[model samples]
Target chain A: MSAPTEIAIHHVDAGRMGFFTDTTVCIGCKACEVACKQWNDLPADGSQFTRGGSYDHTGELSAATWRHVRFVEIAENGGHLPQLPAGNEVDVDAAVAAMENWVFMSDVCKHCTNAGCLDACPTGALIRTEFDTVVLQPDVCNGCGYCVPACPFGVVDRDPRDGRAAKCTLCYDRLQDGLEPACAKACPTDSIQFGPYEELVRTAERRVSELRRRGIEGAYLYGAGDATGEQLAGGLGAFFLLTEPPERYGLPARAESPVQENVVPATAAAVAAGVLAAAGATAAFALARGRR
Target chain B: MSERDATPALGTRGEPASWARAGADVALQRTRWGDAAWSFLFGRDTGYAAAEAQPGEVAEANRRMRSGPLPDPVEGPFVKAPVWTWEVPLYFWFGGVAAGSSFVGLACDAAGDGRSAAVARKVALAAVLPCPPLLIVDLGRPARFLNMLRIFKPRSPMNTGAWALVAFSALGAGAVAADVAGRPRMARAAGAANAAIGGYLGSYTGILLAATAVPVWARSRLFLGPIFVSTATASGAAACRLALVAAGVPAGHPTRTALGNLETGAMLCELGLAQLNQRRLGRAARPLHEGRAGRLFRAAEWMVGAGLALRLVRRPLGPRVHHLASTLYLAGGLAFRYAWIEAGKASARDDEAVALMGRGAVTRGDALRRPGEARRLASAARRPRHNGRVGAAYAETVRRVSLVVERALRP
Candidate 1:
């Protein structure tokens, strides 16, 4: 597999560093989640046990929770396990086999090549770090909350306590000190790998091919190369290798910066239409007055 | 002032001695001021009570996200809901009115109707007065509101819109000042400048909403701008006409008649564009057609329709019809802003809508990968380096255009 060429484009010295989360090896321990919260000093959002009957207690990534572990239980019939009949006697071994494949994916900020939050931030608070990862400067953010909705992944959120938007900083402070992100460092199984963007992409590709060769046909790289058809606009700096579809991990299959297609055209059309309408109305008034 | 008068003597005259006590029972019995001070110093509830007190819909949505059964992969909110509150839509409405009225003032000035122009300018100034405060108050940190002006970011609609609002307000104020200072030429020039900025101010709000990941807003990107501008025009003209009439302008006056015609025309355009946008959005537009947002949109439609009907029967209804129609148009305009913003919030929560949008993008991507198109994309992706000359030329062109625009916009 050829290495991805777009690397160290932002800052030559540090190189573009990112995560390659391989769900195949993830143990669903959520040590990454704990380490992230502890490192970032992010307050716990809530403690309600999810009704999904999964071990996922932290619902999803929020302003407080940066790393979320998703659990997808697949039945032997290639569907979710059905609720068993209350009175029916079931075979334990058969039941266990039916629910054998349980997928656990630890999700974090994709840190896209073209980040939506960075593009949408009016306050210049969200910036690209030397590692080519997006980071929000809480001090600079005036709590406009535009970044919250702008993030296609729904990663950035407004901290209710402080009113400023918060998200994974890709451990920018740690990277500056020559260390990996808290999540990747804490990951026990090396499922969450952090390194140069190009190296990670190559590693992810090789792993996916290896998995497929070993009869894991569903294994594929997402946001790396063209594995999932068209790439996310500018592609994601942090990519993933997943056995299931991207949506199974609460990730969009296709994402684009709204600025790329929506903002400029919409602004131009609006301004043009406004000018035309205003001019037309003025002309009508001018003509009416002149006639009078 | 004497120290005795400046400082209140604790436990003196009518004051109770218990107020100074540190005991819990004494603290409870203290005056409201003492209680407030105690709470201010020691309260653990310093966190945002407002965040905790979310509206029922939002609370319910949060509850579902927390405790509901796992959503189908393709059918749950994939984006965070907007944190904007009542202040945002209110700001949009006021900003629209300011923009709209400035346009009317410019139109009146162009038509040589000085009285009507002066009234419209004043209306514009009055409308713009509350915009800054509303916007600042809505910010997560009101003190950091100045951060919006700390940079020039054209990529962000919110940033550019802020700059436009500042310029619009300044020019609107200048126009009003020129009118007061008996400088008709200056007033006319300032009014024209304000109207130019106003055109942007009216439309940028729409762009701001559309340029997000929200399904309904993004899907209707093309129409939101025009829809907002049209509503702004209708409302601005309506405000001007009402003011002109109240100032004793005859119903038959050319300015009054022109404004009336303009209001009706803009209202018609707004209604048409909204309908077209809703149609184009398809399933993504469900938020605009259901729940609280839907109700507001329907009310706006009814009000606009009624206003138009009133305009049509003005000959029979007399000048009273003008007042009624103008009022309806203003109310309808406000409703449009609120409805659109509310709809956007709802749309962000609709996972199915966003999932469908993502699916649509994937389908388009698939279509593009057909044989020759795939090769083009692959080659583009494989290109080792960006062509520097083309990049420099593009940058130069952009720089030159912005310089020209800046020069033209300068007052």
Candidate 2:
């Protein structure tokens, strides 16, 4: 792959851009999903059928389906749903009016600060755009598919037909023209809001505080890491504010970076291998003396 | 996007009906997400729910991990179905043998055993010279293989490995050439460099597997590297000793005895570390105990045990016994490498293991259930499988301790 800086030499800096996803207000209208397909010119990924139980069933993020909306409906004892809104009080009657009482969050590529797919792509086909979000240079990808499993979030995949890797670009083409991502643009409630990265984080934090202040206990902003700790992919460029645990929204409870997970074990294994080889060499003398 | 491509019309990725076919994926398109509303009242993976959540009916559990119906409809996430196939593992075995033989050559040189050193060097060259070609074959084409050298990203091990292979091969060629040209000093220096690289060459393949997110490989990270090196050196010892015996090295030669002892020690470490890794991994180790992988693992264990027994009487053992043990040791080494790979595929195929890499104790029943059984009977061990996995672990520890005692007090 060509050098990122040299590749972007003609294009001036656009500053950092990202998505501020508030899953709280999402209506799951799927307008963003449809719009992304149309803009990207991607084919439908076989999700038009009734998938038994869930509404908004595009399944998951794949090579084709860049933006996915996940629906989770939790009900306790009776038929009453867990629509315990900001007040923390569950009412059977109010939940009935809440679109079958399912929490809807539109999911997309996290575009992590430390993107594993980018790091793992041997061909350098995955590179950081001027806006700092990761994009796939499909023409340069050699179809190695290393980025597929390398993704901690499993957002990338090899297109079976072309034998090349594909994923969301955060609409890199749109960003060049000072336009927002298609999913964000088509979002009816502005749940998938796109803006400057820093501004989005600040506003997302304030939104979290607002939601929590209103009595939503689980209202936390995911992928907005500061100096304190690193969260999903060391804080995603595309992050979210959710009213439930990450797992409840089809996210990892602890979305660890592949680097952290790999380094510790790799070091230990390397050390052990080196030590065992040395020990075996020394033990040979002792064992031979006994044999004689 | 080519108009001719027309979306590729890829089918759902499911297990193929013809099990013998390799890498052919069929479409059973499924969405992994579903509402956890009234479905909570029913058991999971049992049946599909026709009804949606009742009006306002709050559900208890709605974890997206639990959203998919059980007995997974799609093939579990294998990512790339292990990019390095038969050629890679075979290359690993050959490269390891070369590395191990280099150590033998070094040892024989130090001990002033020129005949043994000569054979070892020849063996090392013979084994290693084929690696790059095997690796290229695995990569599908020489051009694609060259693509690996397109970058020097140490952050990516694949990048480092490509560069390392080039260096290792060049150094190995230089050593063999010097050895043949009767330039002992140049051969010595080249051999030393080759040996140093061999340390990495012999074991980096295992590290490559461990560095991946695959649960079985990831969990065995601490042991895989060591295990690879052990097998490499042990089998190298066997191959070198057999070559010397064929070259008419005297029956009572100290070099032969020492090599035999070295082989036993390495194999013992391999046996102990292998079981320890598998047991520590618990549910993740399931792949090592079932199917073709399991058979291969068992064969490797048996061969190691036989080789160890042969080592006990190696000083008095006839040339025929030495040859038999040598064959077994080499076979065992190959078995271990191949089995480790097959186990990786098995580990990836299991949906439950893929999903549940626990931070702590999960369920005991997950560990206890044998392969392909849907009915999970949760006993005292539960899903996290504390005691069941430990059953194999205890036996291994006992066998290892006895072998250590027997070898240590042999004189």
Candidate 3:
């Protein structure tokens, strides 16, 4: 897909830039998360060790926690992963054998082509940056919170301290300075790559084919092509290379902007119904008066 | 019979005294903040430290807290819950009332009933008075509420709705002023203008809710607007009727009778549309039928039903029955608004419903596709199926209902 027209209108000769997160290479070390938090100066949410003995304690992405590492443990038997034994004596080999795969995905905002949050914002708080990335202007936001539910990925949220919506800007400031995002810079495995949109898509396509040739049949590009049901409104600025279903990574298989479908029909129906009902009421009143 | 002897002497200093002393000791221990603070600071083995001292027990509790079935990542609450509180729905109800009353006032003027028209105009103005403050108070930054008018973005229903409300309020006030000044022609023109704006004011709140990622609201997009407008009409007519009664209008006044008929028709339409929308939503409508929202919806339905019944019997009971029916309609209209907003909140939290909607499973026929786009995508075998079984079933039901209604209307 071509870069959105808003990009050309807003910035002269600026190309669209985005992230390509290859989950297949993710190490789950969470360096990206730490770097994101550090660079953004986000407040710590305190330590929370998840119940399943999984190392992913920082839960889903929120206002403060932009980049999140999700841990999915799949079982070889197509059932739940066996819980760790309560006794001190544990069979490590058997437990390991029972697991089919343990996948880690670093999740962030999609910066959709047809962004729901941007369309839903009443105040001009959310804007498309020169690099075609969606950015929220915190100062202009009246904190109406329409953008919260408008997000299809459940990414943007209201900061409790201030009540203004917050999400990843895809590092707009860093992009302007010719520097990579902190998450991409800190990723040790090169899992999170940042560059021009076209180049990244080509690289992702080659990697997917290479992975398939290497017998990893599940390797595919999400949010880049129409093949995956996960194609969002047009496509995502930030997309992923995955080895499992999109849902396994807490992503929708398909998404649409409510604005395109719902607004016009609803408004038309309302106006039509209102006019018809008013006419009927007026007729009833007029007839009753005439009969008087 | 021997209670006095069997109860023993009151306050006798024996085993009872020892028990009382033990109780007092325990209460003193509980109330001693200084001792608790000292134990907390120094890690002393006071009785207060017992719970923290047992690491094994604490660990077990933590384990239990975390231990449960693993969450299904696919069944996601895909969007954040709406931040709107009570004020938003209250504003919607008041706005509807104002909008509906303005229309009724215009209708009364068209019918040449100037007395009732003047009263309706005043009622519309009063109803609109609370709307702005209610909307502003619900904003996260109340001080910057005027920022809503900063840009006129037609793409956003909220921005347009805000502008409509401002215009409606101004016209309503002007119409009321003209009525007081005995300028009937000017009042009629102003009231007509207000009613024109009211058409949007009464129903745009529904569009506002529908134009969101919330599953239930978006799925019912076709019907929410009509439902809300019908409720607004019912409540507005009811309010005008009550105002006329209070103004010492005769029970047999043609205007009063006409309003009763209008209110009844609107209430019936509101009830029918709500049911049809719920049926179409299927599993996604769970929020509307199950919880605090469900109870409110049930209450609203019953209130409307009772009002309809009262309307049917009002001929025998005289105009006093009109008062009760009108009150019921007003209350039901308010409750309907609250229930709908509450249901939208709950639907946003339903991960499975949201995910299914995203997958084009629940909201099947409501695909956001251009003409023949679905066919083209289907030919390529890339598009998600948008005509699923549930959608077909809902379509069949709608078809059947329309047929029945058509046959009933035919001579």
Tell me how candidate 3 scores on lDDT.
Answer: 0.74
Instruction: Give all TM-scores, in the order shown.
Output: 0.80, 0.71, 0.80
* Model 3 residue B37 distance off true place after TM-score fit, in angstroms: 55
Model 2, residue B312: C-alpha shift (Å): 4.5
Q: Which tens-of-lDDT digit does each residue in A1-292 have in candidate 1? A: 2233322234455667778887877788889999998877666666544424443557878877899887666423345543443444445676456445677788888888767888788877777766767888765677888888888889998866556777898887666555577888788777787777876666666665555555766666667655233566466778777766555666665677765557876887899988987897798698678778
The parts of candidate 2 lying over 4 Å away from their true place are: A1-12, A27-59, A71-101, A143-145, A213-215, A225-227, A268-272, A275-279, A282-292, B1-84, B137-142, B242-252, B290-296, B310-318, B345-411
Single out the weakest 10-residue window by summed lDDT for candidate 3 chain B: B13-22
Model 2, span B27-129: residue lDDT tens: 4312211111122322222121223323211111212222233322222232334545687678878887887887777777666666677777778887888
True contacts kept of 2: 0.15
lDDT of 3 at B58: 22
Give RMSD to native, each candidate.
15.6, 16.5, 19.8
Candidate that beats the other on lDDT, 1 or 2, i.e. the better one: 1
How high is the TM-score of chain B in model 3? 0.72
* Candidate number with the higher DockQ (1 or 3): 1
Q: Interface RMSD value for candidate 3, one decimal?
A: 20.8
Write down the lDDT of every candidate, Cα atoms only.
Answer: 0.73, 0.64, 0.74
